[model samples]
Target chain A: MHEQDTEGVKIGLEVHCQLTSLATKLFCSSPSDYRGKPPNTNICPVCIGTPGSLPVLNRKAVTHAAMIALALNFKIPERMLFFRKNYFYPDMAKNFQITQYDRAGGVPFATDGHITLDSGKRIRIGRMQLEEDPAKLSYDGTIESSTQTFVDYNRAGITLVEIVTDPDFESPREAREFLNKLSSILEHLSVSDLNLEGSVRCDANISMAGGRRVEVKNISSFKEVERALNFEITRQRSLTSKGIKVMQETRHWDEIRRITISLRLKEEEQDYRYFPEADLVPVTLTKQFVQDVKKGMPEMPEERAKRFQKDYHLSGETAQILVREKALADFFEEAAKHSKDARQLGSWLAVDLQAYLNEYGKSLEELKLTPKHFAEMANMVSSGEVSRGAAKTAFVEMLKTGRMPRSISEEKGLKVISDTGFVESLIDKIFSENPQAVQDALKDPKAVNFLLGQIMRATKGRVDPAVANRLVRERLAAAKGSK
Target chain B: MTKKQRQEQFISEKEVEHLAELAKLELSKKEFTKLRGELNEILGYFRLIDEVDTENVSPTYHVQDIVNVLRDDTPTPQQPDMLLEDAPQKKDRFIKAPKMI
Candidate 1:
C-alpha cells in the first residue's frame, strides 16, 4: 500500500520567547537571571503577587518587544494594553497572569506579521503579545510518582513575548524551517539568547485533513518540535485509517519517551475571564518611539546574508552558513577587513572552522582563535607562504593553543619550501637514496608522483606538492636525456 | 414588581454553585442559598447603572488618567530568606506544595 500523504497536515505554533536581554523581571525589580540561582530566591512582593503589591512594567522590555515586532514585520499598535487572564495553577503565585489580550478593550503588542521561509513559504503571524512567565514547578520524581512538588518563583515574572502564527505550515519540515528562520531572526535582534535553556518554548496545534486539532505542549527545542509533529501526524493517520475520529484535546510532549501523551482534560472549557489590568496603565507607543526603536535595531540575518553575498562575492550557500549565527557572521566580517581573499576566507570559516568547532565540542566564543589569526592564515595560503595542507595542520595547532598562524607555522616548520636551491638539493638527495624509484620514474611517468610523495614525507608537508612535481619531472627528463 | 421579586430573578443557586466551583469555595446548602441571595442583591444594585443613557461614552479601563507607567530594567537587592519566611510549607529554599498528580 502507498504511504499516507502529509500534504494535508496543518501546524500552527505559539512560540514564547523570554526577553532575556533585560536585567530585571517584567513587573518587578527582581533580577531576571534566575537560571543558576537557588530556588525561590529571585522573588519579590510584586512578582510573587503579594496582596497589596502593584505591578510596574519594565520600560526596556517594551522597547525590546517593539524591536522584535518590527523585525518580524508586525504592526505595532498605537497603544498597548495589559489584561488579567484568570486561571488556577500552582506555577502562578497569582491566580491571574498579566498578559495582553486582543479583544474587550485590549490591544496586543503587535499583530499581522509574517516570516518567509527559504522555500518562499510565508508563515503569517496572527498576533504577538507580552506577558509574564510563570514560576517553575519541579517534582521530586516523575510527576505521577512524586510525593511532593516544589515551586521556584524565580522565573515567575520574566518578560515573555508570545508569537502566535496562523496554521500555514503544510508539513513537519516546513514547520521546522519556519522555526529556524524565526530563531535566526530572534538572535539577530539580540532580545533573547536562544542558547539559554528554557529561553524559547513552543506549543504546536496540528490537524490532518480538517480533522479535530490537537494541541501539543512542552516542546522545548526546534528538533523536538519537528519530532512531535511527525509523531502526532503518524498517530492521527493511524486513527483515521481505522475510521476512528481524532479527538480535539491537549497533549504533552514527553521528551524522554519521544511521544505525545494525553493530558487530563478539564471538566469545563477554560474561562480565563480576561479583564483590563488596572494596576498597569496602558502604554502609548508613539510613532517616534517606534522609529527610535527601529533605528537601534541591528541588521537581521537575511539582510546580513544578502550583504555578505554582495560585498564578499560569496556563494549563497556559503553566505547563509556564515550568517546563521550572528557571532560567526561578525567574525567573518571582522576577518574580511584584513584578509587578502575574502571569498576564500568566507569558505574556510563557513566549512572548515565549523568542522573544527564541532569536532572539539566548542563554540566560537570558547576558541582562542581570533579574526586576525583567520585572516593571517588565509593570506598565507593565497600567497604560497604555506600549502593548504600545511596551513590546515597549523590551523589545528592555532585552535588548540590560541597562537598566531605565523608563529604556529614557524614553530611547526609548515612554511612552503619556496627556495629553489633547497628543493633541488632535497630532490637530488631523494634520487640518490631511492635509485630504484628513480629508474622507475625514467621508465614510467606515473612513478614520478611516488618520488614527490617521498619528498613530502621527508619535509612533513612543508614542500608544496606542485613545486615538487615540477622539479621531479625536470630532473627525470634530464636523466633520460643523459642516458 | 417589588425589588425583592426582581432581585430573586437575578442569580440562581446553580449559577452560585458554578461560581463556587470556579473559586474553589466549598459552600454548604444553606451557605449556597444565602450567598446566592446576597450575590443577587449586589447585581441588582449594579443594574441601576443601566438606566443611564450614555451611548457614546467609552468604557473606562482605569480610573487613573495616566499612561506609560513603567520603570527602568534595573534589579534591586532582594532578601530571599526573609521572603520565604511567610510560606506555610518550605523545603530547602523552595516552596513545597502538595503532589500534583
Candidate 2:
C-alpha cells in the first residue's frame, strides 16, 4: 500500500452559526440584535469586559444551543463547562474570550454527532459548542495597505454555536452541499435565521495525500466556501505534482481576487491557552430537560423531504430541492392544501416558479405571489380553464401585481376558449380567409397546423393547442366533404 | 517583596521579555529588570496556595452557586453616539485602531 499511492484529499469544516434567535448576548443582557446598528450601541459593561464586572450566562442561549444539538442528533453532555480562550485582538474587548475547550475540564454543550447529506453520505460532527462572538472589524482600505482599522462592538458578546466537522469531504462540491444541508437544518430548527450578516461562517481545512494541510479562513458565503476549497485543492495538487510539499499554514480567501493567500506560517504559536472560565458556572442539563427540548423539536428537513416524496409522489431530487428552504416547503404545503393534485402543484412550484425566482435572483419570500393564488393557477391549468401557457402568463402577471390568478387571467383575457361552437367559428373564419392554406391542409395533414397557429395567435394563446388542433381538423374534413 | 517567597524561581527574566513582547509593550532595560523582580515576587506569594491543595476537591469556577442567569431576548434602544464619545479616536461611528500589519 505504501509503494503506490492514490492522492486523496481530506476536508474538514469549522462552521460558526450565530444564535440570533436568542434574545440577549451570551453573558450579558445587551440586545443581540446588533446587525445594522451603529457601532458600540449594543455594548454594555460586561460585553466590553470592564474590570470588576462579572458575567452571568444567559439561560436562553444555553437552551438554544441544546436545541441545535438535539436537532443535529448530538449527545448533550451532563455538564457543559466554559473556558477562557486567551487571545489578543481588538475585536475581543476581553483579552481572553470565554469559549468551550475540549480539554482542561472543559466540556462543550454537545459532542459526537453526524448529519447525512442529500446524497446519503454521512459527515461526522466533532463537537458543537457555545461561544461569545467578537466585535466587527473593518479596514479603511485594503487590509494590507489600510492605515487604520475600525471596530464595531455591536456584535460583541453575541452567542455563537460553533460546529466542527470531521475530515470527510473529498471534494469542494460535497463541502458546499454539506453546508447547504446544515444551514437548512439550522433554519428548520429555528435556532438561527441564517440570512443575517455573519449569521453563518465557515473555515475549511484541506490537504492532499502526503501534502501538508492548509487552512482557509474568512470565507463568508456558501459559494465562496466551495470556490476557496477548489482553489486550494488545485494549488496543492500542482505543488505536489511538481515535487513541492504544501506548507502547513493559515490562508485567507481573498474573495474579490478569487484566490487563496497565505496569512500566517505554521511556526507561529497558536496560543489560545484555554483555562476554565471563572465568571460563569457550568451549565447542567439533565436527561429530563433534554427530553423536554426534544419533544418540542420540529420535523427536520430529511423527514419532511421523505414525507413529500411519499405523500405527494414527488421525485427524490425535486423533494430535496423543495425542502432546502423552509419557506418554500411551507408554500408547497399551503398550495397542496388548496389543490388535490399534489403532483401538479409540486411541478409548478419546483420547476416553473423556482425557475422564475432563480432567473430574477429573487426568493420565495420576496415574490408577491401567494400560495392561494399559486394553487388557483395550478387548478386552472389542470381543470382546462386555462392552457398551461396561459396559466404561466397569469403567474408572471400575478407575481408582478400581487393580484389573484383568476383576476389576472380575466384582466389579461387569458381564459381558455373551450366553447366548441366558438372554436369552430374561429376555425371557419381562418379557413375562409386562407383558401391556399386550406387547399394545402387538404393535401397535407401538417398544413392544418398553420391554420391552427392562426387561431391561437388570434385568441392570444388562450385556446389550448389540443382543442385548436381538433377543431381545425374537423373543419378541414368538413371542407373536403363539401368538395 | 512578600515574605512568602518560594525558593524555586519559575519565571525567568527572559520569560518577562517574552510576555512584554506579546503585550506589545516596549520596556526599557532598567524597567524590564525592575518589573521582572516584582512579578517574580508576586508569583512566589501565589505559590503558597499550592501547598494546601486537596486532590479530591472539585474545581470551583464561580463564587455563587446560582446558575441559569438569563434575560429575555429583546432589544433596548441604545445611544451609539454616547458610547462613541468615550473613544479617544473615532471616525464616523467606529472606534479607530492602528492599521494591523
Candidate 3:
C-alpha cells in the first residue's frame, strides 16, 4: 500500500453547499424551496435579471452562512462584500455571478478555519463566501453532442456558501473523509439537508509537488469526488513518470464514462474579471451578531458524540456511528428515554436497526419506524417477551407494513412463548407423534433434538430454544423409561 | 508622459478587446478602436476621483448604512408558468438557448 516519489499529492476542495433551509432566494423574495417545483416558477425579476431590477440581499442567507462558519470555527469578518464573477454560460442568466472575492478592500464572509477528521487529521479551511447560485442547465444530449441546452431558473439565485480548503489532503480517501465529517457537521447545524439533489457540489484541485494543478469539476457525489481525485492522482503519476509536464487545466468528471476529460486548457481560461457588485449592498456583521449566532448554535457532532459515550456509556465506535446522522442521533436519544438499558438499546440500534436501514438503502427518516416503536421493541427484548431473533423479524415486518412491533408480532404470531405448562404439553405431543424419536432418544440422548426442533417449528420460532430443549429432555427421559 | 503612467489612467485598445472578450460581447474592429478612446476618457474622469486628499477615510462599500438586510425564510407563492411564458424561446417550461459547452 505504498508508492515512491508520488507522495507529494496535494488536493484542495472548493465545496458549494446551497442554503436550502432558507425560505427565499438569496437576493430576491422568491421562494427558495424550489427543489421539485415546476421549472421557472421560482424565478423573480431580481433573480431573472430583468432590466432595472436590483438585488436585495436576503438576511436569512447571511445568517445561515454565518452559522456554517461558526460551526466550522471560521474567522468571521465584520464587513463582507460580493463581487461579480464574470463568466459566459447559458445557465448564468445574469452573465455574471455575484460572488465574494477577497481583495484589498473587500473580504470574504469567513476564513481560516479547520475541521479535524476522526483520525485527527485537520484540514484548514481557506475561506467561506456567501454567493448566489446560477440557473441549472439541462442538455438535450451530452455536452459534446448536445444540439440545444435548456435552462431552469427555479434554482437560480439560491444562496450558496462556498467553502475553500487549503491543499492539505494527501489521499483521495482523506478527502472523502473530510467531506463526510463536513457534511455531518453541516447536517448537525441544520444549515442544509445534504440529501437533497445538488445541495452540495465540489470542485477539487489536485497537483503533485512542483507540478501544475488540474481542477476536476462536476463531481456529483462524495463517492465521485474520491473517484475523480484518485483518477487524477494516477493520471498525474503516469504523466510525471514519462517526464511529460502536467498542464494546468480544468477537467470535467465524466460520471457516465467514469473518466476525467479535459474541458478547457489554461490558455482558454475564463478570466473572471471580478469587481465589487454594485447592485447589492455590503453585509456588515456586528460582533454581537457573530456572538449571538455562536450562542444559538446547537451541540456539534464531536461534542455530542463524546457526550453520548460519557453519559450513556456507549462505546466510542457505537457513539460515533449513532451521531453520524443528526436525525438518527436524535432518534437514539428519544428511544433511550423509554428503554431502561442504554447499552442494549444502543447495540440493537447500532447493529440490527442499522443493518435493516442499510439493507433497504434508506436513512432513518425514510422509514416510518418511530422512536416510540423502536423503544417498545427494545424493551420487549429486554423484558424477555421477545427473543432477539423474533424482534428482528418483527422489525422487518414493521418496516414492510409500517406497523408497530407489537402489532406485527401479534399479527404474525412471532411472540416468544414463555409458558412452561404450554411448552411441556407441546413437548409431550411431539413425543407421542414422533414415537421413533422417543425410541431413538433412549439409545442416543442427542436424538431428542429432533423433538425440540419440532416444538420450535410448531411455536413458529416463538418458543425459546433453551426452554424447548429442557422440556424435551425431561419428556424424552420419562418416555424412554416407559419404553 | 511615460508609457506606464499613461497606461495606468487610460484603457488601452488591447485592454478594451480583452474586456469585450471576457464579457462575451462581439465588437467590430472599427467600433473596438473607437470605443477604446471613449472608455479611456471616461476612465480619466474616474482617475480624477482618485485625486481626493482624504488621507484616512474609510471606504464605503454601500451607500446605505444598513448592516443586516434579511427577509424571513419563506417561499413566495407564484404561478408555475408565469416566467416561462415571458421567455422568447422555451421548450417544456425551460428557456431554450444555443448549444451549451
Candidate 4:
C-alpha cells in the first residue's frame, strides 16, 4: 500500500491466542482437551453456567494473562473486572460472555513495531489487551440435526490473550506477519500450541474512509484473514463511491461466498448495557505484584532466535524455522549444543529431520529423539562413509529400528567404495567379463567413460562416482603405456 | 461498587431472568422467584469479604503448579467395527446427513 495523500486507512486487530495452560479450562477445573474427551463429557456447571453454582476463578489464567500483559508492556490495573458481554448464540451455553472490556479500567499502552507489508509498508501497533474466550460451535449447515449440531465447551474457559494493533497495516500480508510474530511469541512463552484448533483467532477490520468501518468477525485462519479483509475493503470502497452509506456494523465472513455479510449493526457500549459482574470480585494489582509476575515469564522467542543464529552459527532462515515452534527449537539446541558442526546439526533439524517428524504426525516428544540423536545423525552425513541419500534412508530406519546410525549403514551395506585396491580389483573383473566393452574403452576417445560405467554397474553404485572415474582414467593411462 | 454488585446485592427479577435466558436455562416461576434471595446471600458473601485488607492478597485465581496434563496425541479412537448398521446415514467410511441448513 503506497502511503498516499488520501484518507488514511487505520487497522487495529484484536487477536486471541488460547493459552493451552495446564490442560484445565478458565472457569472450571475440567480438562480443556477437546479431542481427548467425548463430546458433552467435559461440560460442567461453570462452563454450562449452572445457576446457584458460583465460579471459583482460575488463578493460573490470571497469572498467565499478567505474564503476557507485562511482556507486552501494559500497566496492570488496580482492579480487573469481568463483565458479562451479553449476547446469545447456540455456541455459547452462557448467553452472556464474561469478558474484560474497559473494565481493564484505563490502562494505556502504545507499542510500535515495523509491520512490513506485502506492498512493503510498515504499520504500527496501537495497544494489545488481554481477554478470555468463548466456546466454539461447528457449522454442519443444518437447521437442526439435534445430533450433528455439536458444541465442545471444553475450550469455553481457556486463558487467552488478545493483541490489538493499530490499522497501520496497509495490506493483508502485513497483518498476517504481525499475527505470525505474535503467535510465535505466545508459543515461546509456552502459553499455547500454535496448532491447537481454534487456538488463535484474527479479526481484521478494514475501511477506506469514504465508508464506515466494516468489522469482519472470527476470520478462522490467517489465509481467510487476507481474503476476507481484501474483499471487505473492496466492498466498502465500492459502496461508499456509489453514495450508499456504509453503515458501521459487525459482519461475518461467509467463507462460501468469500464475502462479508452483516451480522448486526455495530452497537455502542450503551447497547450491552455495561454492568459489573456481581458474582466475581474485582482484581487489584500493586507495583510489587507486577514485579513478582514479571519474574515468572518463559523465555521470549525473539531473543532465543538471535542466540540460535549467533551461538549455533545457523542461518537466519534456519533460526527462524527452528524458533517458530518452541519445542522443536529447544530440541535442536539441546541435541546440537555441545557438537562441533553446529551448521550441519541445524540443517538436519531444519530440513530432513523436520520432514521425518511431520510424516509421523508427531512433534519432538512423540518420537524417541534427543539433541544427541540429531547430532549423531548429522555426523554420519558429514562423514563420507555414507552418501547423503543413504544417510537419510538410514536415519528413517534408525528411528524405526532403534539401531545406531553406523550400525544401520553397515547392515544395509551403504558404505562408499573409496578404496583404490577394491576399485582396481572390480575393474579387472569388469574388463575380463566384457572384452567388447574393454576394446571400446581402449579405442574410443571417451573409452575411459565406458570403462568407468562398467566399473560402476559392476559395483552396484556403492563406489563413489567421482572416485570410480579417476581410477578408470589411471588404469587406462597405464594400459596405453604398456602398449 | 459495580452495577453488577448493586444489582446482585439488591435483587432484581428482570436481570436474573435475562441471565437465565442467556444461559438457555428454563427456570420455573418458583425457582426464578426464590433465586433473588439465594443470589443475595452469595453476592452478600463477596460484599463482606471485599472489605478484607486483601491489600496484599494477590487474588489467587490459579495456584502456581506445573503439571503436564498432556497426551501422546494420537489419532481419533477406533470406530466400532460394526457401526450400529441401523443408523440413519452411512456412506463410504462416513455417515451422511439430511440437507444441512
TM-scores for every predicted model? 0.82, 0.80, 0.78, 0.58
Chain A TM-scores, candidates in order: 0.80, 0.82, 0.78, 0.65
Ranking by DockQ: 1, 3, 2, 4
Span of 10 residues, lowest total lDDT, candidate 2 chain A: A1-10
* Pairs with steric clashes in candidate 1: none
Candidate 4 residue A131 Cα shift, in angstroms, is: 4.4
By lDDT, the better pick of 1 and 4 is 1
Residue-by-residue lDDT tens digits, candidate 4, A187-282: 777677767667777787777666667788977766577677767766776776788988878888777878888774432223454455556655
Local distance difference test scores for all models: 0.90, 0.83, 0.83, 0.65
Candidate 1's error at A470, in angstroms? Answer: 13
Query: Model 4 - which docking category?
Result: incorrect
Question: Compared with the true structure, what per-residue lDDT tens digits does model 2 show for residues A1-483?
Answer: 011122498999999989878878988878888777767888877787777878888777777888889878799988888899887787887888888988777788899988888678899998999999999999966778889989888888899989999999988878878888888888898888888877888899999889888899998876578888878887887898899989888899888999999884634356677888877776789898899888888999989999999999999888988888888898899999999678878888889888888788888787767789878888888888888877888888887778898888888888898888898888878888999999999999988778878987888788978888877887778878999
Question: Which candidate number maximizes lDDT?
Answer: 1
Ranking by TM-score: 1, 2, 3, 4
**RMSD from true fold, candidate 1:** 5.8
Q: Could you give candidate 1's per-residue lDDT for residues B1-101 as a string of tens digits?
A: 36565646588777777788778799888988789878887888787888899899988888999999889999999888887999889988989888865
Question: Per-residue alpha-carbon lDDT of model 1 for A365-429, expressed as tens digits?
Answer: 89857899899989999888998878889988888888998998898888899788889999989
Task: Please identify model 4 stretches exceeding 4 Å from their true place.
Answer: A1-12, A22-53, A90-95, A103-132, A135-158, A207-213, A221-270, A337-339, A351-373, A384-483, B1-101
Comparing 1 with 4 on DockQ, the higher-scoring candidate is: 1
Considering every candidate listed, which one attains the maximal TM-score?
Answer: 1
